[model samples]
Target: VEAPNQTIAIEQSQSDRSKKTFHPVKVDLPGDQITKVTLGRLHFSETTANNMRKKGKPNPDQRYFMLVVGLYAVSQDQFYLLSANVSEKIIVRASNPGQFENDSDVLWQRGHVPETIVYHGRVGINTDAPDEALVVCGNAKVMGRVMHPSDSRAKQNIREVDTNEQLRRITQMRLVEYDYKPEFASVMGIKNTHETGIIAQEVKEFLPQAVREVGDVACNDGEKIENFLMVDKDQIFMENVGAVKQLCKLTNNLEVRIEELEQWNRKLARLKRMSSLKSTVSEESKVSRCSRATSLLPSKKSVPLKSNKVKLCSVKIFRVTIIALIAIMALCALTISTLCLLSVHDRHFEKHPIYRQVVELVTSSSVALSPSTTTAALQGESTISQSTQPVSRIPEVNFCDILPCDKVYCCPIHLQKVKFLNYEKTNAKEKRSRCHCINCNFIMLLSKISEIIKKKTLFLIFLGIDTTISSIQILETQQSIDSRYCSKNLQCRSGNYTYVIPINKYTPMDVEISLEINTTEPLIIFLCKVTFGNYCSPYSSSQNSRKDFLETTQGRQHIWTLPVAKLYDSAYYFRVAVPGFASCSTDPYFAGIFFTDHYFYFYRQCN
Candidate 1:
């Protein structure tokens, strides 16, 4: 068969296995006008077909025939095969000269040619249908990197990622080491080795963009084709980058805060040193003042005779004047008493003869002694000698005269409950007899001074400095009392102690309790949340009881974090107890409990 623009060559081999040559067969058919052809008598003999079938070879004896069709173009040095079937068209061409030796090599040459091959539609390998531009159904080995399109112009709606949220989500993700099932592993050509990765389901919960649904090719367990959730590791890696950036920012902030705290600690140390030095100086000054006051007191040998005589004369004059004043007070009191009696019993005394006789006798005695008494008083005055030095008299002052008697002195409205006394001012001069008002200004000043002093003293005590003059027993007793009354609902006692922290409705539900404890021995800590006004007991049936043991040495510090699922208007109690037969009464333990929100902002203490 032949055509005007194409040539067809037909060859047939004899039934001998050793024969390598073929004989040409010619058919008288027009190829240009006829689009189809049928050859009914072109078949092998019975013996040849039987031999080929028994050997499982189509042409073991070279008895089969071959058909070679070729199309040649004048402008190109290549051979092409074209197929147009069911509205689909395909064109395969071989341009390599070495492929002409074997006709089968020409079909394989299409893939190996050193030229760019472009596909207008999807291309699939080992797959009947592909849903992507290029898909490989089985494992593929690449010697080089495969890059995806990452040009800025190809992307839209690009924005920055929220690194904080990324960090939070990343923290919530659970990492797992898993091995693929045997059937799936064999189908996917994957080795049964432990692999570390995040679960696609869990990743989807936190970051949906990192997970997607993909058709599983290893679904051979009597199940239909199923879509499996697959995780995009690249997306996870990008999210990890953002999370690391956020972590770096947090680390930097923490470093800054630590530095600031260290600075404050240094300042506190310096202030404490200064305060200690001031206390020492004040003690030395007090000793010196006492010594100077003792030295200023005059001794018996140091006083002069003239001064002694003057003191004696002054004493004598003071005694005589006191005696005279006493006599005058007595006479005046008697006269006043007589007048009061006479006025009350005027009628009764007038009718009584004895009362009249007594009154007349008292009047006659007074009349008889008036001249003698005057002469005696003059004689007494003449006998007393006056001191040469005129003494400066001290004016007497009344209690109400010095104070604000007209109006009450009170603190400000805000501080009216605070009590203050003006005990420093004992006396006031008569010339300056005015009401002295202790106003709010003076009270506020005093309060501020007291506060400052109290703060300084507490600071000193906290630093283990014994600034007070109290005895050790006194200090210990005071400390025990303070510990007993440290909190309203909880009291520190021997053996074990329970501290309750009230979580009001205003507190955030999602918060954490952080404990920083310094202990001298091993301690057991119990934490739980209960209804309001309830205590957390060891044997109680409370929910969410977080119990932990703190194994520590002398002065060893430990930090713990407990995530609190607080209910509204609940009370959370964390108890600290000694392990086994130990007790906390013999030794003091320090604990700082901090309540923080989800973001770790401290707002309250475990008071």
Candidate 2:
């Protein structure tokens, strides 16, 4: 609010209108009737009880009183004695003015106060102010809205708050019901009943600016400053605005997701309806074509033997045509179904950002599911210590065209309600066996191991040196020796050998390891020093001389087997040392590990 400027008027002296011999005299009230004062100004003597000149003039020793309008209560010896007439104008000027207590409330011209006016006692407008309060200034304009720049687009350096982050902060805030203590309650006149609101102390933790420190008051010896805190309700509410925005954003996202789901559902229903319609149309068309062809056929009764042959030929042709039409219709239906499923699947996956990662996981699982008979993947306690080469042409069976090859591979892992394919169990006394199918290397799970172990199924651990893997040593546990299968009786070459042949261990107990020998020599293979520990160097010769050794000899041996009690926990390694010598070159061929189970199932691929 800007204050308007005005010129200060100078009043002329009225002593010129008086007689030349006349001196300024003190005006007496009631007895002498003074009709008018020249220049509309009055002065009072120094001795009067109420003197306007004495109050307005700076000097106290003035002989004659200087004049001014006097608007004040006087010594009330007479009730209505003082009266004066002004011809031109009357001006009342003061540094400070007293309150006006009258019948009529004085209204200022042009809605502005000429000078400062102080009022005592409670003054009320639309609102009340404390006693002795001056004029009240409020931010609200006459239109009842706070004043501010109207344009929002003109703002500079604007930054929008992260509504999600603000929502988290709001969740961290605490709301409590509290009551002021005795002294404070008495002062506030809100003593007993509890007030529910956010505490300033608690709110300060998350929203520091919302709770301001007004300043500390000095206490005791003036050394200690006590905290004086206040909560800005407006600031707290402003922070809450962020939470509202966050909720709105969340609601919108949820709405979009729901809409997408609805669209997906609708598309699926439409595809199903189309499939039904196509099938129905194909059946009707086939029936109609068959009927029409039969009507066109010649009657056998009206023809000879040659004509009968021609009729048969015509009937066969018509039947074939109907069949061909049916086939074409079926093919069309299948194509439409495939195209529709793919389109819907792509659209669905596109909306989900994590579909790429899902695809990767699916692809890896599909690679593991490829058919393998020569390589076995161990599940459960057993694992593939040695990696395998990636198999070419992973067989992909799409139960649903909407899913990729990996989806079929990962179906077992993700679907908990489905059981794995059951494998037939073999007798423990069986000499030796190998799974010759893809089902052995792919569809197995850990649950099968426990059932197999309970059945006393002797699992065969076979090792063979092939072109793919140069050396194979079947380990009872994950920690198996890195060595080729060598005979103790007939030795070829001496070197530090280490190999990791995958096995499926169901329990923590040792598994019986037996080998199927293919060589023509009387071979004896022995575990020079069977140890079970990790971090052992594969080339370390320290265990070669150890006395604790297990030797398996076969008089023209076909199966050199180890006891089931010898195998330890998960990871264990053993050494195979050949002490004898065989100078003759013999093809040391050993097959892969073969376990006797009811069904062939693999946990993981060799790779």
Candidate 3:
């Protein structure tokens, strides 16, 4: 906060006024005071404490402290004391700031700080450029310095990674670009031998349990880096990717074939049950056999001459044997599968993000604890092996459109609990809107934001404003999940893992500007996305007029170009239209505001 000044009779300070200010006086500078500082200003909250209370301790009584950091253009040696009324010392600093080649002009707002320190100074640098490392701590004596990284104090020089094992792996790589791919190589390369020695000492506690887990799974360390630096469309990279996809597909097909074979076994089982020997016995067969003994035709009178004994013909067992053979084959397949999955978990395979996510979901489902309260994410495991499980689709999420701004032309539909309502008339004058959280059961916060454009529109009353925005790109993904069927084989998801959007060609940029959408039971959604930058428009804004938009339609992507003239600041921002009743978020519908060029800005705004 700012220190007290003579705004009571404000005037240009005389040199003597500054000269007379060499007093270490005390002043009660209110913490709530708003000051015109070099940085963008924000108020300090009175309710929050400077320090957190211990686990069970009661909050301390409220007390306030006064502090200020200000600058003046007097002499470089100028100093400022606390105001003549308070007991706190004031900090004043002015410097001809040093320049860094990579320095950005952006100023960021600071928030809460947890760490406490007495006082320390540190500086590290490289000839290349200075890093913008911002660290804020609270309630501590602070001091800082800047230095370069190229210093070769013998102890400060950078070193290369040269572990003997790493070297051997390096030899194995036929790298087109001759680079190492070990996960630790880069981390170790910049460190000197001393650092390597330290790391090696802790190998048992920190290093990988398996080589596959340690290096890039498909290749050794040096080879990993070599392939990493190789040219695009490199034969090795293509083969590797092809191999992975083929493996995944192959596993899925194997599951399906197992299920089909099992079904066939069931059919054979039914045939054997119906073809039982007892059931197949016929009266005619018995009669013919009795009469076949030629003399047996006179059996009624020939009893006295009966030979030893009449042996009953044995019934042949045919179908039961066939059924048993089929069952045994099924059992053998099952046993082989169990053994395969019993193998170790490989880093190359299990380390995949999607695979991990799947495993997490499955573990949560199979456990006693409910998923809602669990924050379980699979982390750091060291081994290389494979396990197969059927992938299942998660439950769908419901989505709805957000309410338009409080304008005369807005459709005025706000989500209520499972319903939509129009409060445009009753709450027309209110600044903050109170709407139903929509069908999605979350608050739809509303506030008015200012949008002032200077250009005049062709229609005297209308200024040229296009409120178009990109539609939320939706996708449907089907995955096989039933354990009973999946347990039989991994190939069960033959055509089940199809993408909703059958992309003609997947581009790097296309994949980057993407997000999964919302879905319930039937419809699945994915957002066409851009990162938090200047390339896209905002889907929702607190400050912008919606009435400026001309054409409002459905089933198409809307774009608007915000030209240089339309921009109010170098970091100008625009909002995307929040579709009515579309349980939507700024993230899914908004590409965000990134300025690649004046032309790209126009592309989004143009008709």
List TM-score per model, in order. Answer: 0.32, 0.26, 0.17
> Candidate 2 overall Cα lDDT vs. reference?
0.37
List candidate 3 stretches off by more than 4 Å: 1-258, 270-287, 292-607
Give candidate 1 misplaced runs (Cα > 4 Å): 1-143, 216-225, 280-607
Residue 65 in candidate 3, Cα distance off native in Å: 9.0
- The digit string of per-residue lDDT tens for model 2 on 1-607 reads 0112422233322557432222434444566575555543322211212224455553243221112233233465433335542122112332111211111222221223666553324554433332234323222236675555747788878789888878888898888887755444443334354777887788888788888774543332434345767788877776789999999989998986687567546656776787799899978876776566556666555547456555665676688789889997676566556545544554443332122222222223223222221122211111222232222222211112322323111111232222222222334554144332334322232234454466433221111211122222223222222222111111112222222223222221222454333323223343322333211123322432234333543322334343322221112222221213211121121111111001011121223
Q: TM-score-based ranking, best first?
A: 1, 2, 3
Error of 3 at 571 (Å): 58
For candidate 1, write residues 1-607 as lDDT tens digits.
1122432232233355322223332334466675454332222222112122345533333222223433333336553444322211111122121222222212222223577443456777766567777777556889999898999999999999899998998899998899876666554456645688888888888688888887755444644446778788888888889999999999998986687568558768887888899889867855665555445556555558447655655665577579879997676566456445533444332333222222222223222212122212211222112421111121111123223334211111231121221122323583255223334334443464475475443353243321111111111112111222122212222322332222221223333444454443333433322222112222232533434323332212435443332321122233344333222331221122111100011111111
Which candidate wins on TM-score? 1
Q: Stretches of candidate 2 above 4 Å error?
A: 1-111, 114-158, 191-193, 216-225, 269-607
Q: lDDT of all the models against the reference?
A: 0.40, 0.37, 0.28
TM-score-wise, the better of 1 and 2 is 1
Tens-place lDDT digits, model 3, residues 1-607: 2224511111222344321122222334469996542322222222223333456553343222243443333346775542333223211121111210111211221224645332222322321221224222112243876444554774654665334434333234343322333444343333222211112122223222311222221222433332212122233333445555556666887886687567546656665665565455755555565556444434454654354225422221244457668997676566445434432222233444333333332223233321111111111121222443221221111111222323221111331122121212323643244222232112111111111122211121121122322222322222221233222212112111111111111111111121222211111122211111122124222223334333322222323322211111111122223233122233321121110000010001110
